[model samples]
Target: MTGFIVPGSPEWLRLITPSKVPAILGVSRFKSQFTLWHEMAGSVAPAPVSERQQDDYDYGHAAEAAAAEYWKWKHAGWRLSRGEVQLRNPSLPFAHLATIDRRASRGRSRRVVEVKTARDLYEYGDDGSGEVPADYAAQVLTQQLISGWHDDADLVVWPQYGMPRIYKVPFNEAVAAAIVARCAAWVESLRAGTPPNLDDSITCYETVRALHPDIDDVEIEIDEGLAVDYLELDARRKEIEAAARGAKTKVLDAMGRARVAVVGDVKVADRRAGKHSIALYPATKNLSQIQEHAA
Candidate 1:
């Protein structure tokens, strides 16, 4: 919103703004970074969200609010920031900024706390020590640089069920420095007005499609490098598919009519649900039977 990016917003993660640094910068290294850049640079329209994803997005906000209230009531000396913070250092990237979630402070010591919902807290290594996933670490570290707290932060993760987990990540100056340098480079790219390099991710494909759904009615020459790679990859994919089909056929033949065939605790039979989901080949009624029925 405005020239600054609101923390935790899709636009914030996707683009570089005066108030927030780009999370998809060099630190994250997700293939979707380029896809995010396209969104940030306004080269492509915003991605269309499906119904299920839209529902998740809506509920995520509600969950965050509930967690904020719970945290405020649960812990003593746990206080929340009244408003959000926007930080854009002159030494950092141009027209880009950093924003943080609720800054939770206890006495004179303050730390940033990011509320998260996860199916598994173990992934972040909820051992009180901050051994978080790389992406999550990058997110809060960038926030730290923007917020100027220069202290540790907390990742409060609530699983869909079971108890919540809290991981305390100390302020990582080394990580922060690298992130700042990377953000500066990304800002240069933004000023230069070019999309980041393309990758094989569906995000890149979809972004292209979203920007140019229809092709112009002109036959133009194009580079053959990608075309050659595509042809080879496509052929290899089909070959692998065929090999898979042959392997499955062998397994089915070994099973005959038996439901599940196993060898040394390894299974190679139908793995779907339902009583009739044995996944064997189906036989069709004979043409003679059809004629007889008609008569």
Candidate 2:
């Protein structure tokens, strides 16, 4: 039997509803759970992604489809094919928290499974030991917790450039409890009508910018420490700007009339003519302005 996708299914509803325990506690490499909190509470509008990222997301779904087939055909233990999973438990503060890729059993031993795709296996590697990234680990943990299967779950890591590997994760009640606690605190903040604090990461900065694209200058004095810090940052930025102009001048002089200068990954190309002369990719320049909007 083939596993079917339930895109508009009830489970999918829970998946998108947010405040998910895994996402709240999960840490991506950037160490930003603040993004998840704001997104979950519906504070920020959806951010735009590149076509390449969209393709990767599509690839992940495709890999999941293939995984369902692999388990059913290759693993004798695989039983009753399924698609979307609704991990629900009334005992939990949140009714639903996560979804599993494909669930199977080895004869009578049933297990929930997560199908994940990555470009490199090394992304999850740690100290020569094959350790799943903490975010994924926390995700599977939440999936198992909500599934009521406890320690019964497996993670299928399908590398785009390497063979697929499976790892079994046992339930960690302490970790699960910690996740629940953090989630509860976050939910409380949401209910209290307080916005979550975001880090100084560019991701957060971009998100803020997207949320508030308009600018009408209105100044309000910030805290003394923060004001001093900003002034220091501005001073350094000016210094960098001056240095950057001089550096570019030197490079341009060396280039003379060369079309492109190749220094490792850094590319300095002539801009007087040709298709490359016109900028194909335009990026937002960082600007310092009074952002009067705050929740």
Candidate 3:
């Protein structure tokens, strides 16, 4: 009951782990609830992991150990239980499971510690405030709910640069209860063969494509209203695209030989040399400033 579960294994596929809580709550950037539902329902196979994704996973595991060591050094008195331990509560449904990165305890005071590697601190709060990403909060909350270590948890984030920072996440009983309720309902839905509605997430789109890879040489009539809506949306999209292209050309012309275009202190666009051609990437952080500057 306390060990790492092999990912993609039969048992792992049947249960909802702490990491999957984000997708269940529609907060995960990498996956959608619909995709998770189908994968767990055995309707479609999980997508094959790309080489880049595999490399990230490998780096993450290695970073976890380093993070644990850092946490131990910071809290010398606290006993750190470092391992990929899978914790489960018999009282709850088997679907509700957790595999925490580390658990810290000092004479009965126990807290969960989660290690994360981020490309930047854009999604995190650099201030000492305990603000963290919603997906990460969900994962920690699920871990606390399962482990019964509900006092508080720590999030150790190792950014691509700089030293790792620790964020203290206080437990909220209401949020934990809500998570459990939603997960239970999701499990019931999966048991009843009810899949979640589709969304525009890339994972959901990929899942749908995989579900129907073969194209049938047949025509079927869709709703007339839906068809009209699609056509109108397509026209609007093309118009917007054309306007964007014209604006981009104007910006590039203004830049001339300059590699970067900035509005005040904010960088609006930058040119990068690609294999075939030079690519212009827009930052879009201060679009209003860029627009005013352009005007």
lDDT of 1: 0.63
Give the number of colliding residue pairs in candidate 2. Answer: 0
lDDT of 1 by residue, 1-295 (tens): 2465654366554545422333455334333667667767777766666897688666766667666776677667678876455666556544556565577887887777777775445333343234676677777776676667777777777666557666666778887887767766776777798667776777677877887778788997768997898899999999999997997778677776675554433333333333565554221223344345557
Global lDDT scores for all candidate models: 0.63, 0.61, 0.83
Return the TM-score for candidate 1, rounded to 2 decimals: 0.67
Going through the candidates in the order shown, the clash numbers are 10, 0, 0
Task: Indicate the residue-level lDDT of 248 in model 2.
Answer: 69
In order of appearance, the predictions have TM-scores of 0.67, 0.67, 0.82
Residue 109 displacement in candidate 3 (angstroms): 1.8
Error of 1 at 105 (Å): 1.6
Order of quality (lDDT): 3, 1, 2
User: The CA-based lDDT of model 3 is what?
Assistant: 0.83
RMSD of each: 12.1, 10.3, 4.0
> Could you tell me which 10 consecutive residues in candidate 1 have the lowest summed lDDT?
281-290
Query: In candidate 3, what are the lDDT values of residues 1-295, reduced to their tens digit?
Result: 7456787777788898888989999998678999999999998888888998899889989999999999999998998875766788877764656787888999989889999997545435332234787888888888888988988799999877667888878889999888888898999998899899999899999999999999999999999998999899999999999999999999889998898787777777777666598778777645776678789
Give the residue spans of candidate 2 off by over 4 A.
1-23, 69-75, 106-108, 124-127, 231-295
Q: Determine the backbone clash count of candidate 1.
A: 10
